[model samples]
Target: CLGKEVGADIPFCVYQKVARVRGIGDIVEPFKLKVGYDVLLIKPKQGVDTKIAFEILDLDKCPHPDINQVKKALINNEPLKDILGNSLLYSAEKLVPEILDIIKECKERGYEDVVMTGSGSTVFVLLEKGQDCRDLIKFMEGKYPFVYRTSILIK
Candidate 1:
């Protein structure tokens, strides 16, 4: 309940499992999702205001991914690229150039579906099964102070 007032993503983060958030961030439905890979979280030097990001989001320039499709892909264990190709906060990249830079860098390094997590700054790239991200991490070592190899919490 506290998470709702703090941020929409917080509730989902607290659940730490596959979930479908509905009804203006009040409803959270947890479910089983067969996820096969971990995520690389890269935090840039800059940060963004969640309120400002939402306020300035341009639907035309930054498109929101279809939530149903994302849920279906996760449940079906689809290709990592297909399952995580889009981001709800992608449009916020326009407001924060650093976010866009990180996305571009991740793509150039063969990382797919690189998106800013939650509101800003922190970006995550999905790593496929058996794929090693050491090189990518090394590449980002000096550039970004916070880079973590992490997986979603399954409940």
Candidate 2:
């Protein structure tokens, strides 16, 4: 909202499903998504500071998932378990080790498409269509304070 009020060209700052940020300062380009997936969001009690995450990030050591491949997977309706990932996962996990635990737990429960969202304690598991998340939700709820079953935005 502030960006709009200031007459800034921040197209992907809000209400965007898939966006590519370039050259910093909210310079983003929105991409069209052909499909959406069922998502299970699990946030632990701890929180990560974005600033610190960036500070601790080592570009050489961090894993960078190919954004183009992710975009192609979404557009072609292909499985993204092997393609989609966040570069900030390494730093974020450093701040909150429980993030790794969450990922491990999700995988142990048969979830393959697990990834950390942004720079933090929340990990999302992409669920296959018609997959029930109740048991997972119940399991996560027993461990964490917030466990939500939701879907990714399509538009």
Candidate 3:
């Protein structure tokens, strides 16, 4: 409610299946890119929710950090020198507050474990009841363009 805008990209990108998460080398399954925005990380209908999907990994976001360093580390297939590059990828720093607002909203709605996915527009929220999750998203759709779907954690 702080701002009049909802996640702007959800509508167009929601139903459109984007690219899959890179790496994994075959043991893992391929997933599509259903989201990309500030503060939130959403999983479209085709895959597991990013929250659970990325949970095992030490993932995070940042205000202004060295993305190139992080990418270089990843590209070289070396264990991240700074594993928790929370501030590395910050293409949307101004959106931090927006993300926080969304997280706050999620907390207010009773979700306790909300996490930013890969420093992006997708956000995964841990839910006790899926209906509540659905309802919260439904409410947001009335306010701004958004995507809605249910997915697994690791699939």
Best by lDDT: 2
Question: lDDT of each prediction vs. the true structure?
Answer: 0.74, 0.82, 0.42
As for model 2, its CA RMSD to the true structure in angstroms is 3.2
Q: Once model 3 is optimally superposed onto the true structure by TM-score, how far is the C-alpha of residue 25 displaced, in angstroms?
A: 9.2
Ranking of all predicted structures according to TM-score, beginning with the best and ending with the worst: 2, 1, 3
Model 1 lDDT vs. the true structure? 0.74
Candidate 2: stretches off by over 4 Å: 1-13, 21-25
Q: lDDT score of model 2?
A: 0.82
- Can you write out model 3's per-residue Cα lDDT over 1-155, one digit (the tens) per residue? 21114533333233343223223211222343222222223432232333443443333442443655544543344443244233312332233334445555666876555654554544555343233466667655554344455533321
Please identify model 3 stretches exceeding 4 Å from their true place.
Answer: 1-96, 128-131, 153-155
TM, every model: 0.82, 0.84, 0.39
lDDT of 1 by residue, 1-155 (tens): 88889977777777776688886566888878675668899987778776777676666865556777877877787754554534446655666677777888989988876777766678988776557889889988878888889776656
RMSD of each: 2.4, 3.2, 13.9
Q: What is the lDDT of residue 119 in candidate 1?
A: 68
